[model samples]
Target: MSMATTATTVSLTSVTLEVADLQAAHHFHTAFGVDPHIRLRASEAHSTGFRGFTLALTVAQPTTVDSFLGAASDAGATVLMPAAKSLWGYGGVLQAPDGTIWKIATSAKKDTGPPTREIDAIVLLLGVEDVKASKRFYVGQGLTVARSFGGKYAEFASGESSPVKLALYKRRGLAKDLGVPAEGTGSHRIILGSTAGSFADPDGFAWEAATSLAPTPSTESAAA
Candidate 1:
């Protein structure tokens, strides 16, 4: 491909959630069955209200959605939205004990088989002030645009080996979708692991090269 058409080769490798209490965060992830998909780091950054982002668990069907949500609740996640059918799909929202908001959802309204505690994909959606500007910033960092809807939303294409997919959405609309207010302050309390070098985006989301040092829990026991 020519330089003009060449897409950057960057891809996401890990997602680290900064939390005040690491042990509690680990326990929560363990209970929610997503410990393998995320890493936890110690942070005391002052933050309040919406954190300008959310992590979503895309599952196969409604039954699976309910199963995950139930596990999250039993693990100490606060329900933000009860699981329900929508025009787009069935899903629910919750806030983890460590203050990270998560949404469990599926496009299939009905179950095709018995329920399973399986997550189809994990998407990190950054609620940004300007989707267009953020999209440009990410593209500059070597992430290829997968699907974009003008200024409203943009999804990036991650390598098949990527542990997580990244996307951008207008802050207000995202807040509404996640059932929260659009206002927040202080650090994002999250770090992205990527092949791209370390830098903060236009909205202050941090990314560090995946090779950076840090010991995290093993993914051996978790479902992929």
Candidate 2:
């Protein structure tokens, strides 16, 4: 893991969701952790079916994949797909009550007997109408391409100490992957934060570029 980064470097820290119910959305996401590193943008507009994007949570072990989903289920999250051993790895999908989709998986190739209940990382996958265009746009924005496949998917490796992994996917295919209808998602409901300056992707996911603020001294008292 990398050390904490200063405000000088513009980092994509959080992925914001335009949620209809503020309290419900906050409650559901906060369950991931006291800090899943996300921000929720409240909204009144109602959107149903697919939102054309999904958040991926990477776990450290195969058993941990199941454990995360198990805990998620216990927390009132709807299980889109139960955790099972898959060709790629042990993984499954889930949907928050607010309609945001999440895919959880572990890179651990073999099934380790027990689960650890951990979410090691979160990657935001945006579904774009044109994969090539999206790829070109991010690369043009000074983001290096970490990996690409058949022009359908692309992942950019962020050098920030704790960064939200960024990636892109084919719009319709992504909806299919999340098992949601390919319609009725009005605005994609995504808000990306970065130092790269505010802009929207070709698919309409918004990015808010933040100016780094100086670090401040702690106000708490020292105690033994």
- List the candidates' TM-scores in order: 0.91, 0.82
lDDT of 2 at 52: 83
**Candidates' C-alpha lDDT:** 0.86, 0.70
Best by TM-score: 1
Q: Candidate 2 has what TM-score? A: 0.82
Off by over 4 Å in 1: 1-8, 212-224
User: Tens digit of lDDT per residue, candidate 1, span 1-224?
Assistant: 12234445776778888888888899999999888778888888899989999999999999999899999999999999999999999999999999999999999978999999988899999999999999988887788899999999999988866778999999999999999999999989888887776889999999876743233463211121
Model number with the top lDDT:
1
Q: In candidate 2, how many clashes are counted?
A: 0
The pairs that clash in candidate 1 are none
Task: Write candidate 2's Cα lDDT for 63-157 as tens digits.
Answer: 77767777667767899878777677778899877777889988678865666656677888888888889988876666678899967999887
